[model samples]
Target: MDIKVLGPGCPKCHETERLVKEVVAELSVDASVDKITDLMKIAGYGVFGTPAVVVDGEVKSVGKIPKKEEIKTWIEG
Candidate 1:
């Protein structure tokens, strides 16, 4: 699975990244997590908000931090 966390290296972005890493480790899921800081790249995903979560190329959440349980579902899905 592929998980992309979009932000320009803000505090929330770092928190989101940390949560994702923790969740993945706890679940022992095989996935690649990337932090996207480029505006062009984030815009290409059609996300206008920071701290967005994209799972498997699908926009799952935007503008706010998502819970670990929620993210795990996206990963497992």
Candidate 2:
């Protein structure tokens, strides 16, 4: 699985990225987690909000720090 966390390195963005990595590690899912910070790249995903989560090229969350349970559901689903 491919997961991308889009942000420009804000605190919320950092927390979001951290939570994503934590969940991925705990689940032991074979996935690549990437942080996309470039404005053009983030826009390419059609996400105007920072701290967006994209899984398998699909937008899952945007503009908020999703809870741990939410993150887990995204990973599992």
| The candidate that achieves the highest TM-score relative to the unseen native structure | 2
Give candidates' CA RMSD values in order. 0.8, 0.6
Put down candidate 2 lDDT per residue, 1-77, tens digits, no spaces: 99999999999999999999999999999999999999999999998699999999899999999999998998999
TM-score of each model, in listed order? 0.95, 0.96
Q: Per-residue lDDT of 54-73 in model 1, one digit per residue for the tens? A: 98889999999999999888
| Segments in model 2 whose C-alpha atoms lie over 4 Å from true places | none
Off by over 4 Å in 1: none
Q: Name every residue pair that clashes in candidate 1.
A: none
Q: How close is candidate 1 to the true structure, as a TM-score?
A: 0.95
TM-score of 2: 0.96
